[model samples]
Target chain A: MNAITIEGIEKSYGKTVQALKGITLNIPQGEFFGLLGPNGAGKTTLISAIVGLVKPNAGEIRVMGCDIRKNPTEAKKYIGLSPQDININNYMPIGKIMEFQGGFYGVSVKESRRRAEELLKYFKLWDKRKAGRYQLSGGMQRRLMIARALMGKPKILILDEPTAGIDVELRHELWTFLKQLKEKGITILLTTHYIEEAERLCEKIGIIHQGKIIACESPLKLIEQHRLHEKAERSGAFQFVRSGSLEEVFVALTGRPIEEASKKSGEEKWEALPASLL
Target chain B: MGSTTRLAALVQMEFFRFWRLLRQTIVPPVLNTLLFILIFGFSLGSRIKEIHGFPFIVYIIPGLTAMGVMNNAFSNTSTSLHMAKFDRSLDNLLAAPLKPFEMVLALVTGGIARGLLIAILTLAVALPLLKQPLFSFWLTLYFVVMQSVFFGCWGIIGALRAKTWDNLATTQTFVITPLAYLAGVFYSVTILPPPWREISLFNPLFYMVDGTRYGVLGVHDAPLWISAGMITGLAILLFAVCVWLFQIGYKMVR
Candidate 1:
């Protein structure tokens, strides 16, 4: 069974701004899926729709075989989302936050307390467990978000820019932890700006451009498929090139150069990544 | 999760925040009630000795208490719901295994909880200071709780419909404040001119304020049956609207 199945889901912000056109995809159980996209590429919108934060204009989404709209209570039971924003409650202590989240997922208070201790120490936040959200540093807050997302022991984990602000050492540590979760057969859907992170961690990658899924392939498949197609330069002194990377494939598929966007107005230029490029 | 367990956790979180920010949540209304009691009860009571044989100071306590309950209940849900949107913490709650009615219950309970606390604390501070007697305990509790729920639902609807901070401020100033003032919080509607008094009858809050007045001092402008029926009916209707808004995810979509 698929962990999440989104079928032809369309969302529009207003009359003019179509945030998502028609997105159809399925991530099977226990699969590590990565969604890579530039700014305004509908990755956040898709994630929001999956988590039921945004209602779609059309089509359907199912989480763990339960319809997200019709059976949202059951559908939501399987999802653990670490959203892009640092939206944790500043009033509650870090430990209480996790324990309360655990309670929402049917974990007993005693078991929640035990898991909170274990996860807090693992995330190096054990010392600051009593502190409120504002007391934590940026990276610590991000770590706390990840730890809290895992508190429910959810069947599917959705991480939107989960490692965006962390330092290199902690990022690697988190990667290891995520890999261990994958080994334990938990499906993970990750969206990131870092191509290297996607290549390293995700078993399959989907690249979205302007509200459309442009490609879904493994890192190696993407590399091998687009390797020889990169434009060759005969006029300049072209050096010997090795195999291509996922970053190159991403640019070749979706990126629009900045010089053209410079011709538009400031506002249009700001939105040119997926707007003018489309 | 069991539905009740989810509801309990959400309600607990709401109370936890209310306690965490005691200055913002609990202190302001209590302090406001004290100031109102001092200025209106002491200063104004010197001139106007009695209305319907009760001291001017004693006459306004129930109204003041009703206003406190209504305003606190309204602000509690309005601010809490708006903050959830401003900070995007609402996504977490929506993603949890909670039904729409559950969310409504948890949120409305938060508002009711804060409202009832303010009512109790206001009377605790005022009754002894003014030396007023409680006429009907059950009736007082009914009006307090009903008005709390009424304003609580209105707060939810306002928060959901508000697009900007200005919108919420506009509603509070033009809508809620006027309703509370026109509800006869400080004076009996009998003091108003004939037409104006009839106009005030249309204000739903009049029933609430007059109900509490009747509850506390055994004095009322309208029939007891109408006030009780109107408050209960309006509260239930507004609650149903809130549940519908949540069920449809109204005004909360992209």
Candidate 2:
């Protein structure tokens, strides 16, 4: 059975700019799924709709057989979302932040404290539990967000650009931690700009472009089946390479430069376009 | 999470933040109220005789109490909600499983708590300075609570609608502050000339102040029951509007 099912999801801002245009996806339980897209390709909108942050114009979303719109409390119980930015209560102590987050998810105070302690220690934050958010280093703050997301022990974890701005060493450390969750059989839906990160962490990948799913398959199959690999091989552009990487496949499918895909202005640019293009 | 647990968690976080900055959140309003009593109640009262069968100092106690409650309650929610938007911490609540009404209730609870705390602090100061004892403690308490809830809802609306800090400041400067002062805080409406006296009745805070004054001094400008009914009706109307705004995610989630 699927852990999350999104059918005919549509969202718009006013009469212009349809953010998500009839998106449909099904992520099976225990699978590691990656969603790759350009800046304005509705990745965040889809995630927001699932969490009930933005009400979609039309769609049906279910998590573990509970409809997100009809039974949000039950549906939300199965999922945890670690958004791109980490904005917590800055004045509170780190220990209190985790404890309250646990309580927000309905854990008893004693149980929440226990989980907070366990997660903090696991993230190497136990020593700094008394410190406020301003006292922590950037790397530690990012790690703290993931620790907080895991406090509820959710069945499905959704991470949006978790490693976007971190240094290489810390990024690898986070990758190792996330690997353990996959080992424990927690389903993960990750959205990322880093092709290599998705290739290394995800079992299956879906590429969205202009509010539509352009491709969905395993990394190996996607690379082999893409036309770029055949053309590159025939034209001797990558003569010594054994096979095209996921990055090459992504660029081929989206037909846009990686730099252009990563720009923050892309969202605004899309919004400024006419509805016909949107 | 159960709705009850989630609501408890939200309110707990708000209280924790409030207590963490007790000096900033609780002290200024208390100090301001004391200063007003010293200048207007004592310094000014020494020259002026009794206006409403009570000394000028005693006549203004309920007005000052209502002012403190209304201002503090309004600030608590407005500042917190505005900061939540600026810092994007509201994302935390939005992503949670809480219903819109629960979220509104949690925020309103924080505002009312802060307002009541300020009211109590000011009342403590007033007890020693008043010329006569308060007439009915329960009635005074009721007006204080109602004022807090009413202004708390207004605060939510201000925070939700304000797109800039200047916009918020303009509202306080041009709207709320003027209405608060004109609500018979310093002098009785009986002293105002014809149309002005009639206009004072339109300001909701007038009813709040008059109701509490009747409770505190056993003298009031309007009938106690009419004042009570007006404030109660306004509070309920504001509360219903806030609930509707929250449910629709007005100027918030979208």
Model 1: per-residue Cα lDDT over A107-126, one tens digit each: 77788899999999999999
lDDT string, candidate 2, B68-112, tens digits: 888888888887788788777777777766677777788788988
For model 2, the DockQ equals 0.55
Give lDDT tens digits, candidate 2, residues A107-225.
87888899999999988899999999889988788888888888778899999888877889889988898889989989999998787799999999999877888889999889878
TM-score of chain B of each: 0.97, 0.95
Candidate number of the best DockQ: 1
Q: Tell how far residue B215 is off in model 2, in angstroms.
A: 2.7
Question: Candidate 2 docking: what grade?
Answer: medium
Please provide TM-scores, in order, for all candidate models, with all chains considered together: 0.91, 0.92
User: Which model scores highest in lDDT?
Assistant: 1
lDDT of 1: 0.86
Error of 2 at B36 (Å): 1.0
Clashing pairs in 1: none
